[model samples]
Target: KRMLAFVAHKPMKIPGQFRKIFYEDFAVHRDLLDKIFWNLVEDSTVRSLNDQLDQVKAPTLIIWGRHDQLIDVSCVDVLENGIANAESVIFENVGHVPMIENPKATAERHLEFLAKN
Candidate 1:
């Protein structure tokens, strides 16, 4: 609950029904989550993919939350500049998980991008 609040721009907006599922999922995946965290800390080489962004040839749609707490929105600039074929959309007043924050808008953007590409 605390971590969710930290990551979400408006945690209170999260549906009550989904909260239980979220908690259960987290509890089940706790070990996997710990492993992933440790791996990220230990593997310095996997820290950033910025250097390899130029190698991406496929059409890329970068969706980000303007108020993301985990990763600052400024990184979107880096992605746009780095990727040759990249389109980005920043969701205003959204946090780390924009899909959960605003699913309709997020899905619309995804569908639009998919339709074009």
Candidate 2:
């Protein structure tokens, strides 16, 4: 619950129905959470992808939450600078889970990016 709250800008504002589903999913995936989190941390610390960013040939759309607590928004600068064909959109007043925090905006941006790319 605390982690969920931290990931969202306003977890309390989430609709009850959606919140219920989210909690249920969290419960089902709880056992894997620590392993997944540690793996990501280890991978990021041990592996450096900065050199290979230019190898990516596909167009990329990077959507991020400006208020993300888990991953700082400053990382967007590195991505934008590294990838030749990369575009980014930052959601204001949103945290880590932009898809759940602002589904409409997230969907709209994804559709737009898909249509263009």
Q: Please tell me which predicted candidate would have the highest TM-score against the true structure.
A: 1
lDDT (tens digit, per residue) of candidate 2 on 1-117 = 687789987774658898799889988998799789888789878878877788888899989999999889998999989998899999999999999888999999999989999
Give Cα-based local distance difference scores for all models. Answer: 0.89, 0.89
> Looking at model 1, which ten-residue stretch has the lowest summed lDDT?
40-49
Tell me the lDDT of candidate 2. 0.89
Q: In candidate 1, which residue ranges exceed 4 Å CA deviation?
A: 13-17, 44-47
Summarize candidate 1's per-residue lDDT along 2-105 as a digit string, tens digits. 87787788875557788788888989999999999888777747656788789998899999998899989999999999998899999998999999888899
Per-prediction TM-score, please? Answer: 0.87, 0.83
